[model samples]
Target: MSQQENPSSLRLQILTCHLAASSRNMASEKEAALAAVPSDSRTIFDKIINKEIPAKVVFEDDKVLALRDIAPQAPTHILLIPKVRDGLTGISKAEKKHCEILGRLLYTAKLVAKQEGLDDGFRLVINDGPNGCQSVYHLHIHLIGGRQMNWPPG
Candidate 1:
């Protein structure tokens, strides 16, 4: 589906397990309390991670969540996000200590893309700030595939 066709289209299914008591919504679940930028951060990622907003969960782990992008640029466009924000805004905000997370996120992207049946080819993108056309502030890995990509992707 296209963004223009259905603006609020999120293909998420319940992929998380609750370990604490909260309200009816999973958005109020256990991890919700630990969200550092909970209020200050309202990006699509926040919604995807918090279960406040829905998304097609492609792959998930204790520290990560991979889902299909609502606004797909390719036949397969998935966003890989950290379950814990850890103050990462983008690739630029990555510090020396972020090596583990940075690697994990990328590794997860490849795994997700392959799981999507993109054995032919795929691309991993990390859009930075304004110049990088990054609308969302949270760090995310864009896994695009199902076609022959080109160089100098702009």
Candidate 2:
């Protein structure tokens, strides 16, 4: 008998097709949203910095702010970002003027990692452009720890 002749098989096929379509639609929506925002435009991180959006801030100084990552990759995942953009959309866009803020971001990451009690070790990540999996345009450092990290991180 043909696969469609079986009611259970036909139901499973329909469900699979629906899931595939949903996935495609979701992907398309994400692409559209990304395209809608210019690379130099203010991002969600800007909102967080301006206090327009609430975040679980862990550390804050005149130059930088550290907050817990909403989508934590580890038990202790935090994001360190400069309080001012200064045309730093990402590390790839960094200029000589950005050196000071860049160093401050990393140093704050270390301080935050220690505050989180990551005595064993931790990882600091700076995803760049679209190919680098940077969903946000604002420059930020990711501090991930509280678990054993594997090599060649994703």
Candidate 3:
């Protein structure tokens, strides 16, 4: 015979699930208001990394991958990101252990810029949370070049 379920345990489970869902809803609303993606969810970058989406890959290694941005802000706009996230949703979530990969990403950006023939100069940008206008949840470096950039970026 099957044992009866405990009423107290059942109620606790229901309450826990409700609380978790409510928290997620609240976070989603906040992200939406700021025009940012949810941090805890898998973003479009995953597709790019998995080769499910087409991207002009400029560089790739075991640790990082660099690809041309679909919507290019400059003549040469490359995005560099870690192949494996390892819980690094954004730079804001970086821990001490992530330092090596973070440095590798920046160094990769410089290497790509040289390969792209940006002899004059190049710009590297990393948008953090919502205030920084980060629409994607994944952490990435934007290597932009091939034009004269204006100060006080628009």
lDDT of each: 0.69, 0.77, 0.76
lDDT of 2 by residue, 49-129 (tens): 999999999999999999998777789989999999989988999999999999899888888888889989999999765
Clashes of each: 1, 0, 0
Question: For residues 101-123, what per-residue lDDT tens digits would candidate 3 score against the true structure?
Answer: 99999889889999999999999
Model 1 residue runs over 4 Å out of place are 1-40
Q: Can you give the lDDT of residue 103 in candidate 3?
A: 93
TM per candidate comes to 0.71, 0.77, 0.75
lDDT of prediction 1: 0.69
Cα deviation of 14, candidate 1, in Å: 35
TM-score ranking from best to worst?
2, 3, 1
Error of 3 at 10 (Å): 35
The root-mean-square deviation over C-alpha atoms between each candidate and the true structure, in angstroms, is 14.0, 11.5, 11.5
As for candidate 1, its clashing pairs are 12-55
Error of 2 at 106 (Å): 0.8
